[model samples]
Target: MIEVRQVTKRYGTKTVVDALDFTAKPGQVTGFLGPNGAGKSTTMRMIIGLDAPTSGSVTVNGKRYAEHAAPLHEIGALLEAKSVHPGRSAYSHLWGLAQTNGIPRRRVDEVIELAGLTSVARKRVGAFSLGMGQRLGIAAALLGDPAVVMLDEPVNGLDPEGVLWVRNLLSGLAAEGRTVMLSSHLMSETALIADHLVVIGRGRLLADTSVEALVQEAGIGAGIRVGSDAAERLRQVLAGPGVSVASSADGELEVSGLSAREVGEIANRNNIPLYELSSRAVSLEEAFMELTRDAVEYGKVAA
Candidate 1:
């Protein structure tokens, strides 16, 4: 597990992260989300000890990342995929990393196959495509089979198949009871993979909750759709103090403050014939936008 307690980071006179506190537990995928310039990268850097925190502390599995004798075995991270030497081959780069912290060469080979880089394992790093580089980075991250894995934008250059592979890979890692924390701008993918979320805005913690809880709290694009021949009558019947009913251009009733069952029961009680009643699915992207609307640094103005 990764624990960040009251951590803060400042660069000169500017504060990048402020008193942030959150935990990424084992057996779950935790998504780190925020808008641009929200200190996500700074916070991740602090966690892996790339950048020191100005105050508070960050620990990986009960100790600082640097405190572990075999840091690679404790935590594996991919902060930047293109940080490797251009002269080295993919296999050579991973082999070098394996040598450090006493990781064996066999494990390096295994990760290469796992990351689908076996065909290009001997290719020079500089000649690899963006997707290939991402695969290599992921292979390096899994090199030590660390108990905790952290990645920033893991699917940045991946194609559809590669994206699906990454989703499955992260899920499988978490299933093995490892702590998995990733930051991504893709909300749809994050929603599909992450069980929990730690949302930050301007370096402060906005939410640390489950995916279901966050979507429910946002309460946008959530309601029952009522289709009936007597749509106007059904709307009036369902209307109450806390309830809201809106008519669509197609003569469907968009209802809030009541479940489908309640609406159906109310309509049945009033002898209103209903043709269709279904709940509208809430989009994760919509909820994300709602939660971070105020926190957006470069929001666009209305035309």
Candidate 2:
């Protein structure tokens, strides 16, 4: 487990990350999400103690990272893959970390195999492809056999197979009751992997909740489509309570909030929709957009 207590960071006079508080629990993958210059990196740096917080505090398990007796065994992080020495082989690099941390040298080979870098373990890291470098970085993170894993953009450069491999690896780690916190701007990938989401905007907490709760809170329910006079009638029936009704580009009624089942119930109850009725939930991408739309610090203007 990890706890961030009112953490804040500043560079000069600009506050990059404001007072934010959240907890990352074990047995789940928590996604850290934000747009460009939204302080995602700064916050992550604070979490790992790479950058000191101007105020507040962050702890791995129950203590600051530097204070932990065996930091690697407590928390293993892949904040940036390029941090490794280019000239060193993947095997040697991990060996060095294991040696310094008093971890068994045998763990290096295990991580190499776990990350699918066994074939290139002896090759210089600089010569490896971007995907290979990412795998090597992951291998280093797992070398300590830590309880908490933090990965920043773990899939930044990888083939489809590598991407799937990473997803499975995160799930497998979390299933074993280890805390896994991964940061990524890719909502689709996060949606598929994370059980919880910790979204930040302009360095402040936007949402800290489960994926299912976020989808429900975003009101992404099945959409209703109707074109007959029943359209207006069905609209009225769906309008009550928490539902939202709108017209699609094709002139079909789009209803959110009520499920297809409930929409069909109302339609059948009113002899209305005989056209189209299907379950339609808003994807994680759409929900993330809605959540962070107001928090983007910068964006390109329309041409």
Candidate 3:
């Protein structure tokens, strides 16, 4: 597990991360989400000790990352995929880290296979494609078999297959009771993979909750969409206190205040022939945009 308590990061007079507090728990994938300049990278850097917190603390398991005798075994991070030496082969790069950390050399081969880099394990780092480099970085992160894994934009340059692989890898890690914290801008992919989310905006915590909870709280249930030959009759049937009915260009009804089941029953009772009845649930992307709309710091404006 990773715990960040009242953590803050400042540069001169500017505060990038404001008294942030959240936890990345074991047995789940926690998504760290924020827009550009929202201090996500800064907060992640503090988690791995790449950057110090100006105030408060960030601990992995029970101690600070630097305090651990074998930090790799506790937490493995991939904050930058291009950190490897350009002249070294993928295997050589991982071998060097393993040698320094006293990790078994055999683990390097295992991670190579795990990250699907076995075929190109001997290739030089500088020659690897963007996707291949991402795979190599992930391979290094898994080399130590760390209990906590933190990755920023793990699927950055990945293809569809690689993206799916990452999703499966995160799920597999969390299933083993490891802590998996990932930061990504792919809202659809994040929705599919993450069990919980830690959203930040301008270095402040906007939301920290489960995927289901966030969607529910967003109130995306735009009500049931109904299609009927007797659209006017259907609207009347759905109308009541707190109920609203609107017509679409396609001659269907967008209804609120009544459940799909209730609408169907009402239509059946009223002898209204219906063609379609479906409940509308808010998508993760929509909910995310709604939550972070005000928090976006570097958004573009349309002319």
Which candidate leads the pack in TM-score? 1
lDDT of 2 at 280: 61
Q: How are the candidates ranked when ordered by lDDT, highest leading?
A: 1, 3, 2
lDDT of 2 by residue, 83-116 (tens): 8899999988999999989999788878999999
Cα lDDT, all candidates = 0.92, 0.87, 0.91
Q: Write the per-residue lDDT of candidate 1 for residues 132-221, one digit (tens) a residue.
A: 999999999999999999999999999999999999999999999999999999999999999999999889899999889998877644
lDDT of 1 at 158: 96
Candidate 3 lDDT, tens digit per residue, 152-260?
A: 8999999999999999999999999999999999999999999999999999999999999998777645678899888986787678999989987888888888878
TM-score for model 2? 0.90
Q: What is the Cα-based lDDT of residue 4 in candidate 2?
A: 95
TM-score of each: 0.95, 0.90, 0.94
TM-score of 3: 0.94
Arrange candidates, best TM-score first: 1, 3, 2
Best by lDDT: 1
